[model samples]
Target: MAFTQQEIKTGFKAIFSNFGFVLLWLGQLTSQLADRIFVYVLMIVVYQSTHSNLGVSLPLLAFGIPSVLVAPWAGVLVDRFNRKGILITADIIRGLLILLIVPIISKSLLWIFLVSLLIYTAAQFFAPAETSSIPELVEKHNLIIANSLFMITWMASSIFGLGLGAPIVNFFAEKKTLAISAFLYFVSAGAIFLIPLKPQEPAKKKTHVLKDFLMGFEFVRRNQVVRYALLKLFVAASAIAALSLLAISYASQILGIGEKNFGYLIIVVGAGMLLGMLTLEKLRHYFKMSSMVIMSFLLSGAVLIGLAHTGDLRVALFLIFLLGVGNIYITSTIQTILQRKIPRPIRGRVFGVQNMLVNSAFTLPVLFFGFLADLGGILFSISILGWLVLLTGFAGIFLPKFRTV
Candidate 1:
């Protein structure tokens, strides 16, 4: 359903008045900030010690591998257990894990990878619980605004966290940086503790773990809304991942800028994301959620195609900014739809599936596009991706299931 102007105004008021959502948002903000900082610090510590790119890649593998292997089961656990308790415990465990890294920083790379693995494994559980909590905390009408706020904070944290990481590490050093990240996790735990979620009733009949895991995939297979939403999210994620790999080449060849200056383009994209979040409610007044998603896909595809042909830095920056706006529209709209449509009992499991697809997008799409860039040239690869996205958007217009959402 599309939101009216009055509903949009009321949604903003609803979000701020709801204290439970405020606390959830706070917890999310702090936890995400800590996560970004932890990653930055990990890269620095690993590079300083081993002075090898492979050493850095190993830690990233530790982070990404859990989403593939452990996330589905983690969702099962989230469904069976008390979500609030799960969230708090996950934060505390991750906090302690960050602290554990300090004493082992100088020991061995193997030990560091082990700790990183544990930390991110805990994160797999934290993620599904956190996403599943939102529908519980806010009115259905407010879901769009609430998600906008969350995504806004997420982008802000990425920009500020990475931007500040170097200076923070330079001043405080690596050990102190770890301490600060740990403290933020504790703060997140504290915020989550204040949210007034009622206890989950115990399941009357326990299902087998394998059955429960398969149930999530089965539901997605049968539910067209969820299936398509996830597909759009995967495509969006893949586009972002491919762009991340290609941004360096785009900067160097197309814009005549050095590779290091690619960050400026990213910052512009972040700014556009912030703009998109702030303006999303107004946009919703004019378009259905499905229309927004379709338009965003088309927008992103067109921007990429434009970038492939453009030589002017200003025009490239504008296109990249538009891509960021399209990205937020696609993600935030579909997330709200999932929250509204999915039954509460199975919410975590579906979102766990989502996490798996999104993380997989980062790895597989990056690898494929990196190869494509090498073999076919950066512009050629980008044009191919753009055509795929554009065609998908056009296909969505003709498909009945895509619009039913």
Candidate 2:
């Protein structure tokens, strides 16, 4: 049903009417913010101690690899078990695992890496469960705003977490800062506990768990539109991974700003995304979702190349802001399309496959680009990466299957 003007007038008020979804947003936001803080801490610590560009990139690989390996198993659990229980349990596991870092990190860096792997694995389970739970918490008509709000939580939290991460680390240092990171996970669990949600049972099945696990992968491949959405998201995700790996170096080496100043870049991007999302909601009905996706992909590619080439901080900031604007359109729309198109029975697995595709896309590129930046310098490495994104955008136009998006 098309939204009434009153429904539009309600805007956020309509979303807030669904209290369960609000709790879910709260849980996801804190957990995501905690994730950023953890990354920032690792970034600062590794950069300071080892002073290696690749060293700063290593934590990203550690974060993404676990999610890739465990995503299928996690998706199966999300579909088979109670998602609320899975979310809560994952939070507890990650919270406790992060605390262990405070002790062992002083002894060895291996411990820090290991803890990051374990905590991310726990999050892998939480990710699909949360994505799959959206239909249960909010009505179908509200999915766009619901997904947009979720994306906002993502950028907004990162803005604050990354913006504050350096100062917080400089203030409390690593050990105490990690202690606080653990506490945020507890807060997430508490918020999730307050969410009065029940898991939806898929159509009755006597199928084997392995068969069920494999089905999510097969499901995505069979659907043309969903597959196209995933391919585009994968491309965008890879570019983001490359950007994240290079941001510190981009600031420090190319722009002649200090490394810590990267946070300002993140904050600007977040602000741009916030504006993009707001614009999207207002104009959602003005364009077809498929057309919008294609346009945004092309837009992202153009600006990413711009950001890569610019050395002036002011120009770089504008380009990153435009990237942020384009990114929200792709993310929010792709997620909303996935939610609307995928059947709830298999939503967990679809999202599981999605998590694997994006992060797997995220993992290898971050490492490759880090090595590339070291060898070729940040300017050449990023310029190549941006052109790659632009190429992906071109692919969407020529590929007839993408026309179906």
Candidate 3:
């Protein structure tokens, strides 16, 4: 039977009406919340024990490094294995790893650190499975809705989890907080169980390691639109990382706020994200992905530049919200565009490459920007990066393909 446009829309609506989507979303929400809580708690534990910023950042690097290193391989596996089974196994392993840390709470920090690293590595596997699984389960027209829902839950959970973690930790013992996080992981695993979908078949022809690894890169290279979209993504993600880390410092020093007040900044960003995601479907019809991306970059840069000069906390909060809105719109749109362009077979690898590039871009700014902050004040460093973002955005306008989109 031939498919009609009306059938496509109705089919999506039917999918949303089911109990499975509800359960899956609940599981996603719980897992994301737990992920944020664990990170915040880890930072707290490290800072409390070592009293060193560098020491606290160690766990983050450990987690991020593995994910970046293994993303391509993981992506290939996602395409090769049962995506549902992979996620289920990953969540279970990660949960068990978190639980393992409970006993070592009173032990040396190294032990807990090691367990956290293992849990993060497990998560790297789960991430590609989860990303690739969504497209298989939902209708093509509903991809945007699914992705936006994921992002909404993600941003909200991140803000609230960080906001609540410290207070909960303060009220309860460290071991108890860790236990709570462990439970959340199990809950997330249960949620993965609710997603009703099978995995993709392994590639028909046996492939070599190098060829499999380059799958995502080659796909993007072949698709002109996808390549530009990814480059734009890389640029935007790097600028975001630089600004976000600086905002943490901005809260502590420039705004003279306590650690808890950082939650307010997060909330502002989350609120903006929620708004952007909710309206994105309508926006997508009017504004092309490239247009939205360029506008977001330009506006986000301008906001950062304004923020660099601002001394008032309220104003900084406002700019952050604006930044959040622009960021969400751009990111969600690009993801949707990519989802449409890339076939299901290679989506995992392409997304994995996108993830790797983004992380690589984000990593570079931190190294140099962190040093710049030490030499110059945080404000000046932020201002410099903001200017660079503005330049990139302006240069984007000159690119024929991006402008046409």
Candidate 4:
């Protein structure tokens, strides 16, 4: 299973040489940067508007619920349609939705939430399409590096975008910030057009797509390793979701830091993520997937427990950095493993199921934690999520069956 230096070099050469992948990277960079900016900006605005952490989380609830609800349908569309077309169409619609919110955000918070929800609904389609298209864009052996880069830029964008949010918001002021967000999506659409990717799907039978859809679930049910990896991934997703929602209040209320200062906390987390991926890129050939999987979950949980108790800003930031490291390790490993294991025809649907569960992990927990944080206070709620993560890690270790996974 180990890769040679030559193999790694060739993989890097293969992806970089492909013009289509270069375009895909540009599309991801702009769109994801905008994604971080828009989501965090909107959350901050909502918090400022209502002065309620629950209200802050409501928008995310809106974003996540629709994505989860529509994931299955979106998967079907991704498998059936031209992935490039879906990417273009999604970008256009998401941009328009961001544009529509510009003027109304100052006047109506409700309008902001509604428009954002629709924007994210469109984004769910774009995600699976892009993921499923990757196998077609590069050689099979290069997928680890491909998935690794995908995860890295995603974090790098978040680092730059989140760290830059205050400056961007202050410079553009709120009105132009919305415009900038919309502009990025449109630019992303144009970039996507440059990619020549075409995902090969199964021939249509008059029978029904629901059968094909059910088959994705059947595949999951039958494959023990995928099932284990996916469930482990789901646990990681849930912890991050809860932690992300908590960070806003943690920084603002407890840390006594303002928006800009709080974003730095997130920036540290992003930095850790970048480093984690870099470490993975260098060492992936040397480790078993189970080792990466188990260690990431354990490290994430341990860091969260420390982060929950530490009131010192410096200590909290350090823990957050480790948390980010653990987060990326879990995510990157899951994606690489899944991409390698799944067949191309049903890949979209399976990835779609992943979207559904992960978003559900996000939305439903935020819904509960928003209320919980509001009632019990932020630190207490965050500790619970931390413990839940730790418990999952321990369960993974004790479960003899997971060793095979």
Listed per candidate, the RMSD to the true structure in angstroms reads: 4.2, 2.6, 3.7, 2.4
**Model 1 clashes, total count:** 0
> Where in model 2 is the C-alpha error above 4 Å?
8-21, 132-147, 198-204, 282-287
TM-score of 2: 0.90
Each model's lDDT: 0.80, 0.81, 0.73, 0.80
Residues 301-397, model 4: lDDT tens digits:
8888787787898898888889888888888877778878999667767777877877887687887777788899888788777888887777768
What TM-score quantifies how close candidate 4 is to the native fold? 0.91
Q: Write the per-residue lDDT of candidate 2 for residues 241-331, one digit (tens) a residue.
A: 8887788888888888788767778888888888897799766789888777878888887887787777898988888888888888888
lDDT per residue for candidate 3 within 1-405, as digits (tens), equals 124568657765766785666666777777777777777667666655764434554456556666678777887776677877887788788778887877776667898778877887787787777767677777676766676567767667876786667577778866787778878878878877877776577767888877878877889889988888887788777776665455456777789986434556767887888788767767767866677878888988898788889979889888888888988877777776787899977776788898877766535555566557666877887788778778767876987776643
How many backbone clashes does every candidate have? 0, 0, 0, 0
In candidate 3, position 399 carries an lDDT of: 70
- Cα deviation in Å at residue 142, candidate 4? 4.3
- Please write out the lDDT profile of model 1 over residues 243-359, one tens digit for every residue: 755765677667887543554666788778878887897888888888999998899899888888888988888888898788888888888888888897776677778888877
What lDDT would candidate 3 get against the real structure? 0.73
TM-score of candidate 3 against the unseen true structure: 0.85
| Alpha-carbon lDDT of model 4 | 0.80
Alpha-carbon TM-score of each model against the true structure: 0.78, 0.90, 0.85, 0.91
